[model samples]
Target: MLSQLMVLFGFFALVLVSIFWINKAVRMFDKLIGDGQPAWVFFEFTALTLPAVIGSMLPIAAFAAAVYVVHRLSADSELAVVQATGYSPWRLARAVVVFGLIVALMMSILAHLLIPNSLSQLRMREDEVSRNVTAQLLTAGEFLHPAPGVTFYTREITPEGELRDVFLSDRRNPGSAVTYTSSRAYLVQDPAGTRLVMVAGLAQNMQQSGQKLFTTHFEDFSHDISSLVSRDAINLNKLAFAGTPELLRDPQAVAARTGAAPGAVMAELHGRFTAALMCLVAALVGFATLLVGAFSRFGVWRQVLVAFGLLVGLKLIESAVLAPVLVTAALWPLLYLPSLGGLALAVGILWLAQRPGVWRRIANAIWPWWRRARGAGA
Candidate 1:
């Protein structure tokens, strides 16, 4: 049973991760390729995103594997034969519990190490890509809008790396607009930032309120263009990129560095643990749910639906607690409520599966009301 669970888990995890990864890759391809970036950059970005995608899909895959394995065993009468030999539901669930622990260990590694490192690397790469001005503005005879309210055009480019007949309009300022027309220009990078050094340029400033135009000519003038091309610089101090140990050791310090509230930091720290614990909960719920009621030749489709619904309910509970937890650090314990609730639910289902008389009694009590309602509707 353990071997079957492991095999199915790998298969389901691969299929799910591939589907989600392909979807994300498509959107990244459009954005990166459309921005004139090379194919290698697109591949690097997609590869960096794999850890996060795998992390999100593992719990679902584990749940599916557990459910499918149990369903197949019951369908083949293997479970029935085992039960006849006095193997209780709890005993049968031991393999499933061990499988869940293995998956939980995988989740722990991803949440604590791989995910944070990948996200940090991704952010750094994005910063580099955003600042690559040549790739963004090197084409000749075409107008470029590197940012909203900014337009740049160069009539020609010399092999010597000089821009000819450059025209630039900056309307980012609401009170006045500036237009710079230069006979020649060079892009310069310095310790400060990137700048466009325009020679023999004419600056035209137009006041929006009065529609007045003022013009000035210069031998050379430098205009800061870094903000136009790049986004805000990457801040590595973000809590999302911090290690779990760092977060737990001094959450207030982490909060200060990331400019988040202390409560938010605590919530993030606990959220990681809860995410890993959820893997165990998901696996157990899947196995225990299928163990309920008698096996049918028609299969346990209803039990599968119940298990799916239970997972959804757990997620809903998780979402519902997040806001309050974020508002108060003391409520950090609430983050584990969903996982705890799921474990309780799994235990309850397993107990019910062990007691056939209890199930019959409950069904008998509900069957009369179900029949009466059917007759009234008819």
Candidate 2:
């Protein structure tokens, strides 16, 4: 039993890592390339994204592994042999349940520790890349668009790294367009962030309706470059970024400190635990769904599809609950409804799987719909 559980778990974990890592690497390549980042940066960013991917993959992997293991056992006649040796279906499922618990614990650790840290690191790395790319745009002899609707050009770079001739266009502001031309300017990094300091510059402000261009000559002017950088949409006060203990502490206090919605924070706290606990339910559901049907020489592809469909339906229900609970924390308990419902459904399915009469009844009831689906496909 231990050997079967480990083999299935290891197989699923490997597949999970490969598929998700490749997917993330592809996406990260496009993003970093668009930002003019190096190849190493692309690899680094993709690598940092893996922990979060693995965390999300855990429950699904557990379910798939459980389904596959059960299918394999039934096919090999080992499960039948065990049953003939006086082991009940439920008794045979103990190792699978243990496997589910192991996965759940691993996912809990990720939800509480690794995922948040990795996500935070991704945020920091993205900011760093943005800052570097934005700063590099100040090179002489070429026009650069640091961000959409923001253009900058410098004619020359002094030994002291000052801009000899600077031209900037700001179209980010609605209802007006602004341009700055300076004989001398410099980039400054301060607590506020990167700023372009224009010395003896001409400011041109054009009104949209009238096309009236206003010119103002000034000795000193500054434009903020921080807005041009893409950043994580995460609110610092967001419950997603908080540690487990911090989240469990004073909800109101944490919300006050972060200037976030207390209800949202509280909802996030409970959601993490539910995320972990759902692994067991997912595994049970998959196993029970497959076990319901008679052993097939053709294999359990139909049963696999049914299990996958059930999983998707459960996730849809879970997503439906999040909307209301996130806004109204009083409904926070609704967050666990999908998992609880799945658990109860799994138990009923397991009981039916053990009883041929009940299983036959279910199969008989489902036959029409199954025939309809086959007919439609044909």
Which number leads on TM-score? Answer: 1
lDDT string, candidate 2, 1-378, tens digits: 756766777788889888978987888787677555778888888878888888887888888788888888878887677777987668867877887788889989988998878777877777677667444565678778877888888899888888888999989887798999999998888887788889999999999887799999999998887777665454454456778788787787878876778678877788789888889888888888887767678888898899999999999999999888768878888999999999898888888878979878777899999999999999
Model 2 off-target regions past 4 Å? Answer: 133-135, 138-143, 147-150, 153-235, 361-378
Off by over 4 Å in 1: 138-142, 147-149, 153-167, 170-233
- TM-score for all models, in order of appearance: 0.84, 0.73
Best by lDDT: 1
The lDDT of model 1 is 0.92
lDDT of 1 by residue, 1-378 (tens): 999999999999999999999999999998887666899999999999999999999999999999999899989999889998999999998999999999999999998899999999999998888788756777688898888899889999899989999999999998999999999999998987789999999999999998899999999999988878646757898878999999988888899889988888988798889889999999999999999888689998999999999999999999999999889888999999999999999999999999988988999999999999999999
* Superposed Cα deviation of residue 177, candidate 1 (Å): 5.7
